[model samples]
Target: MMKHKLPPIYFLHIPKTAGSSLGQLILCSYPQGSQLNCSLSQLLQMSREEISQFKCFAGHWGTGLFSLLDKEISSITMLRDPFERTVSNCLFIKRIVVKKFASNPLALDEVEDLKLKSDISELLKCTNIREMLNLMPSMKEQQSCYLGCDIDLNEYLGVSQCSLDTLDKSKEIFIENIIAQQLSSGLLDINEIFNKAKQRLDAMEVVGIMEQFNDSAHLICNSLGISTPKNLPRENVSPENLALGNLTYRKSGTIPDDVIKQIDELTVCDREIYEYGKKLFNKQLQTEKRKFFWFKKMFKKSERF
Candidate 1:
C-alpha cells in the first residue's frame, strides 16, 4: 500500500488579516524554528535550499515564493474585509507609536527616512483627511500594495532578492512606480493581479475568514486531522487592553466616510478578491461539516453553567 504525503505548508499572509495569530497556531503542529517567517529584509536572504528544509513557511510571502521551493506546497490563508483591515491597521500603528514614544520618543529619530514619513504619529498629526491623504502612499498604500499582489514587498515591485540588494531607485520612486504600474495597467487596473490571486487561490486547501476565525480554526484543524489549539477563538488577543483603549485606536478615530470612500477606491482589487475568497472559504468549510460539528459541540458546553 502507498502512503499519502502532505506537502510543506505555506501561508499567504496579508497584513492585519489575523495572520500573526494563525501563524502562531500553525507553528504548533511543526517543530520549532521549522517555520521560516519572511519579512521584506529577510526575503533578500531567502533561498531554495533554506526554504525547502522547512515544514512550513509564513509571513508576507505569496505566489512568488512558489517558484523558489523544490516541490509543490499546500497553502492556507485568511482575508479580512478590506476596509476593516485598513482600520485595524491604522489603529494598530497608532497603538505602536504611543508605546514606542512613551518608552523612548527619541527612538523615532533612528527609523529610516522613508518609513518615518508614515510613522503613526506623523500619520495622525495631519490636520485633516486631505492632509493625511497627502501623507498616504502612507502605510495604507503599503497595505494596498501588499493586497494588490494577492502578494507583496519586492514581489509587489516585481523585484527579487538578487535585484533588491543592488537596486538604484530610491524607496519613494519605487513606490511611485508601484502605484503607477497599477493605474497604468488600467484606470486602477488589477486584472493581472486579480487573475493571479484567483488562480493561486483555486489551488489552496484552506482559505480562512478572519470575521469567522473561531469556526475557521475549527475547520482547519478538523480537515488537517490535527489537535485543535485550546484558546479556540483568538489565541493572543488582550480583551483588557482593548477595553482600556490603552493599546489600540478606534475606527472612528482613524477613518471617516470620505476616507473610507477614498480607501474603497484604492482597494477595489482586494474587494474583488475578498468576495471570491468568501465563496471559496464557505465551499471549503462545507467539506468538513461533520468534523466541525463535533468540534462545535465541545465548545458549546459551558462548565460554569
Candidate 2:
C-alpha cells in the first residue's frame, strides 16, 4: 500500500460486523503504533494532529467525523444480512448486561453506561414488539449508524436539511422516537431511508459482505495491497457457558417466526440494503481478482526486467 502511496484506510466498523476479525487484519498489515482503535468518545478527545498519526482508525463511531475523510483517506466497511445482524445484536445486548451484573457489585444505576447497558438488556429480553420500540438504530440500521453521513432524510422527506453531524449526535434517540411514532401511527417511510443508504454503499471504495467473508477479504486485500487473510479470525464469539467470564455474544439461534417477522418489519431498510450490497459484492470480487492477477504479473515482469 505504501508502494502505491494509496490513501490510508478508514474502517467504519459497525458493531458486530466482523470488526474484531478485521482488526486482526489491520494490526498485521500496518506498522506498530500506526493502527488506532478508539471509541467515539476517545476519538473526540484526540486532537486533529493526534488522529493524523494513525494509518487506521476504527471503532463504533457514528458519522460525526465524516468531514475528516478526504482523497488521502480510503474508507471501507462491511454489512451483514440485516435480519441476522439484528438477531446477533439483540442476543449480544442480552449477554453483556448479564455479565455486568455478575461482576459489578454496585447497583445498576451506579454507572451511567451500566444503566444504559441494563436498558439494552431489558430491550432484548422483551418478547413483544411494543417493548422493543426503543431499540437503538445502531442495531436496526447499523450500516447507517457507522456510515451516518451517507443517509440524508431531508433529501427524501423534503424536511429541514440536517447534516450527518446532527444525525451522529441524535440518530439513536431520533430513530427510537421515529420507530415509536410510526408504530403508533401505523406508517413509515422506511424505503426512503434505505434508498439513501444504498446510495452511500454504492459510493464506497469497496463493500464487504459478512456471509461471503473470504471473498470480501480477498477484495479488501487486492484493493489496498494488504496480504489476503486465508482465515479470517472470529473474535467475541458466544461461549458455551454464555453470560460468564467474557461477554458471550453469538450470531446463532432460532428466532421465533413471530419475532422474526417483527424484526423484518422493523428493519425493512436494512433488508433491502443488504440484498443490494450482496449483488455489488459479487461484482467487486471478480474485479478485485483481475486486479490481483494483473498486479502480480506486473511485479514478476518488473523483477525480470
Candidate 3:
C-alpha cells in the first residue's frame, strides 16, 4: 500500500506523560531529515523558511510555539493521571537527588535544607501542599502549563523559558527553571492558566491519554493516516529499583497519604484536564470507528455490485 501523506506535526510533549513512547512512534512514522527534536530556544531561532523544512517537531517547548505554527501542522499531546503523573515525576527527580547526594557530599546539605529525609519513606513528606510545591515549583499545574501559553512568545523567547539547565546547577533550582516556562504567559493565577490550557486542548487535533497507550497510539496514527506500529516504545520509565542501595520507591511502594493528598490538591487543573482529555479522546475514537464502519460497509456493498 502507498503510504498516506502526513501533515507536519508539532508534538507538545508534557513531561512524564508517556511522551517518550509516543515520541518514538512519531519518530518511526517520519523519514530521516524530516524529524526535528529540539529545544524551545532552537525552535524560537528558526525562521519560517527553516521551520517549513521539517514535517515533525517534538519537544518540551510547550504551547508558545502555537503562535508560530500554521494550520498545516497538527498539534498533539498525551496526558497522564494527574496524581500518578505527580508521583512518577517526583520519583524521577528524587532519583537525581539520590544520585547527586551519593556523588557529592555537599549535595547532602541541599537535601537537608529542603527538609527531605534520607529514608525512602520520608522522601516526599511535607507539612502541606504549598511546601511541596515550593520544593518542586514546576510541579504545580505542570501539564496545563505545557498545554497553554500566551500567543505572544516575547516572554518565552529567552533561554530560561524551558531550559532544563537548572537540573545540574542546584537541587534547590533543579526543576525551578520549568516554573518560568509554566508561567510564560505571565498568568500567575492557576485557574487562568488552566482555562487557557483547556482552550489550547480544544484546539489540538489529538489529545491522548497515557493510560490508554495503544488506543492513543492508534488515534495518532489514524489522525496522521499512517499504520500503527506493532510495538509501542516505553522510554524514560521510572525504574523499579534505584541505584541508591536497593531503594524501592516507585512501583510496589506506597506514596504517603498526605503526599498523595497534596499532589491531588496541587493538580486540580491538571486533573480536570485529564478528565477532559479522556472525554475528548473517547469522542475522537468513536468518530474514527464510525468512519471505519462506513468505509467497510461501502466496500462490501461495492463488492456485491
Instruction: Output the number of the TM-score-best candidate.
Output: 3
lDDT of 1 by residue, 98-172 (tens): 453454556554333323444334444533323334433333433334434532333433344345456442332
Predicted candidate 2 versus true structure: per-residue lDDT over 1-305, tens digit per residue: 34354447777676667777876676567777888776443454455566677887666554434544443666677888776677666656555545545465673443344334323334555433223324555455655434533322222231323443443433233323433344346453445455656776787777889777777777777677666766777777544324333322232333455666767777766777788888889888877778779999999999997
Give per-residue lDDT, candidate 2, residue 65.
Answer: 42
TM-score of 3: 0.77
Rank by TM-score, descending? 3, 2, 1
Q: Give each prediction's root-mean-square deviation over alpha carbons.
A: 7.9, 8.2, 5.6
1-305 per-residue lDDT for model 3 (tens digits)? 21678778988888888898799888778889999886555565566566667889888767656566554667999998887677667666665555645656766666565445433336555333335446555467788767755544544443343344432233222223555644554645677777878887888889899878899999898888888877778788765323423442333445566666766787888889899889999999999889999999999999998
TM-score of each: 0.66, 0.68, 0.77
* Native-referenced Cα lDDT, model 3: 0.70
Preferred candidate (TM-score higher): 1 or 3: 3
lDDT comparison, 1 vs 3, better candidate: 3
For candidate 2, list the clashing residue pairs, or say none. none
RMSD of 1: 7.9
Q: Which should have the higher lDDT, number 1 or number 2?
A: 1
